[model samples]
Target: MPFPIKVCAVCSEEFELKPDKPGFANRCPECSIPESTGDSSTKQRMDADERKNASEANAARRQAMRELLYRKDS
Candidate 1:
């Protein structure tokens, strides 16, 4: 295997090359990526919730408007 003679910036580990992971060793072979948190489930859930809440709010507003338009101001 071709390896570069480099050292990790974060862990300070020795490797064949400086990893593309910013500060990790290229030889670490995982968890070397600085931005790779791996999972985004919470973010996805929050996004879904935001969309759902907006949709619900819109629906509620439309319903209120419809009620007002037909409501005989009693």
Candidate 2:
């Protein structure tokens, strides 16, 4: 039997689907390869670290302002 035609989600190209294969792909072969090359976990971790650093900096700035306002001029 001939394979049925399916459209790729990423490239919007049509491809033949293999019925015998266990894993079926939503995107065509060309578009799917690039998607897997990047490490998502590393990217997420970097983003989280950046946010944490920004929060700490803001807190330190506010503390300095409070100390300046409370100090008595000699």
Candidate 3:
């Protein structure tokens, strides 16, 4: 029998469950599969670093804009 269709929690994509599988999955097949890196920990670390870098860049831009507006007031 075919498994019922379900929504993935991570990607919010619709997918069908595998009837041959024994357990339930919260994420879609794409999201469920980890990055094909030699080391999962390294991949996770790189992702974290990217997030941090992007966050820092955004904060810097906001600060620069605030300074520019302040200069206009002066």
Candidate 4:
């Protein structure tokens, strides 16, 4: 099947919207190229840390719920 045609949000050009296209659905491939800032690595590190902390918190919450549900009261 042919890919759907879409108008680029940035350049206002028509382009094929393919499944493997990067970035946003509304943006064309050329316009979808991510602009790199010098702090990208730092940002990635921060994001990883945030994900780790969130995972830990979620695990703690699940453990608490399990204990509460499975506890025996006499």
Best candidate per lDDT, number? Answer: 4
How big is the positional error of residue 10 in model 4, measured in Å on the Cα after superposition? 0.7
Which tens-of-lDDT digit does each residue in 1-74 have in candidate 2? 88778898877999887655333477666665654556676564548888999899999999999989998888
TM-score of 4: 0.49
Q: Model 2 off-target regions past 4 Å?
A: 19-24, 34-41, 44-74
Q: Candidate 2 has which clashing residue pairs, if any?
A: none
Lowest lDDT 10-residue stretch of candidate 1: 18-27
Error (Å) of candidate 2 at residue 15 is: 0.5
User: Each candidate: RMSD to true structure?
Assistant: 11.0, 11.0, 9.1, 5.7
User: By descending lDDT, how would the candidates be arranged?
Assistant: 4, 3, 2, 1
lDDT of 4 by residue, 1-74 (tens): 99999999999999999888889999988888878746556554548888899999999999999999999998
Give per-residue lDDT, candidate 1, residue 25. 46
- Ranking 3 against 4 by TM-score, winner: 4
RMSD, candidate 2, Å: 11.0
Best by TM-score: 4
Candidate 4 local Cα displacement, residue 9, angstroms: 0.8
Q: Worst lDDT window (10 residues) for model 4? A: 37-46
What TM-score should be assigned to candidate 3?
A: 0.42
Full-model lDDT for every candidate: 0.66, 0.75, 0.76, 0.88
Candidate 4: give the clashing pairs.
none
TM-score versus the correct structure, for each prediction: 0.35, 0.39, 0.42, 0.49
Model 1 CA lDDT for position 42: 46
Superposed Cα deviation of residue 26, candidate 3 (Å): 1.4
